[model samples]
Target: MTTTYDPTHPRYDNEGDMRDELLRVYDLCHGCRLCFNLCPSFPSLFEAIDAHDGDVEALSVAEQDKVVDECYQCKLCYVKCPYVPPHEWELDFPRLMLRNTAVRRKHDGLRAKLTDQALGRTDLVGTLSTMVAPLANAVTQTPGSLPRRVMEKVTGIAAERMLPPYARQRFSTWFKKRVTPTLTRRQGSVTVFPTCLVEYQNP
Candidate 1:
């Protein structure tokens, strides 16, 4: 659909420079749809784009809200977008969306504070996981346990999911002892990320 922007928009004033840059970046989007297809966010984003193409102001408050809510913030699109590569670095879509998301939060208010809280605090999760581990294990093993239902309700993680048991010792502590300095020359140094499975489940 053909799109047209209004000469006057509520947020348009004093945003000429930003608007120009956004248009320039929009032109760089080749419509290859590679990132679109990869992202779970595309369904909402595609709708917004289609709406705006017909009329810049056609997007209602609800439509814009839904569009921003769908972004998982995983940055998969940033990594997958073909335009992000090359010497030119024509990639601006992710940044643009981020900026738009900020505008959304400011204007529409926060939507996923609980999810953010849960994802951001690793220490809290680790502490809670260890504290209730025995009960957690039993509930998972037991039939029709309340804890099993509660877990699914709060996080939407399936009750039937096979979660690894917590380790008796933390992996970091074990690694400190096991990791020894190699004095031999011509040998390469190894880097390890110590994934969740290896670090927490099987120290």
Candidate 2:
């Protein structure tokens, strides 16, 4: 069986529909501990349901939120799950976690919604930070810095968590400057697309 994903499907729009699907997927995952070590999200979900006597519905929304929050979209579970869609089980743990997070954000408070929006716009943040890379790097490195303290208080990011430093030059800029023109025409052209981590944090 081939798995299909449709972004514009009604299930994505209907909160009740998404919630039912989420519960269904969670129930299936509860029975299969195959992905227990793939990521933190699975253990958190399993522990919560086990605490409620294997009753997923008995877990509160906040408990569910905890499970979703633990998932950082590592996609390791997708690679490990034998029941991934096309299989009769149709379990897609990472997508389920993403859907769960979307639903949660829809009902989240203003502060949470704002913080998530900011975090998700990595391109915008990277560009702005790169413009002031020196100051931004200094701020991130300074222990107990005022900006760091303020960020922690406002966004709930732990003060001790070392933030990624901005690059003095953006990745695109560096890549463009470093690329040398070939004297002879190449047989094939290549394009490179860097992820947010490579573009900003590791550039």
Candidate 3:
């Protein structure tokens, strides 16, 4: 079934405000293509925006999922933008992209599926790596294989990409081996958020 967002659709409480803002940013696109030079996804994004109209789904559920997979979650585009609007203004393109991701998640529920199955269960991933790591490496490294070729075609991750070898010991394991006493901070407590990448990626 082909489902599309409609202006009168009851699912959209915010109407097309998000979509309009995104399109507005695209309208402001100077055609300088600064973001294009930063990441592979940007080039695709540039093309999408160049052609996208009010009715098109340039950043829909399926399309956004593809973007999430293809993009390496790099902030290079954000840094390279010449006219990146501040949050106080309503013209932040990066912020718009992040909001688009959230809307996709809220509307389509793909983010939960991806995260719960692939991202949330680190322990399960670690367990699977014991078997899949070698096979993944071989398939990717092999010159002519269905798995290697198919993986490359579907994911855009290069078959010959030099993936890091799985560490023999996990961080917690290494941390447990240390005999040094833990030091307590005498001053203010600090919260180290691992969400920088997440924020940047979606944004």
What is the C-alpha lDDT profile of model 1 across 1-203, one tens digit per residue?
20112224345222333344444444344245566665555666555657577342455546644644566677787787766645364564555556555544344423244444544675566556656767555765653467866766665546676656765556776888895766767787678887665666566
lDDT of 1: 0.55
Model 1 is weakest, by summed lDDT over 10 consecutive residues, at: 1-10
Best-fitting candidate, scored by TM-score: 2
- Tell me the spans in candidate 1 whose CA falls farther than 4 Å from its real position: 1-91, 99-112, 139-144, 156-162, 179-187
Error of 3 at 132 (Å): 15
Q: Write the per-residue lDDT of candidate 3 for residues 39-98, one digit (tens) a residue.
A: 666565566655565333455645434533455656666676666545433344444555
Clash count in backbone of candidate 2: 0
What's each prediction's clash count?
0, 0, 0
Clashing pairs in 3: none
What are the clashing pairs of model 2? none
TM-score of 2: 0.68
TM per prediction: 0.48, 0.68, 0.45
Number of backbone clashes in candidate 3: 0
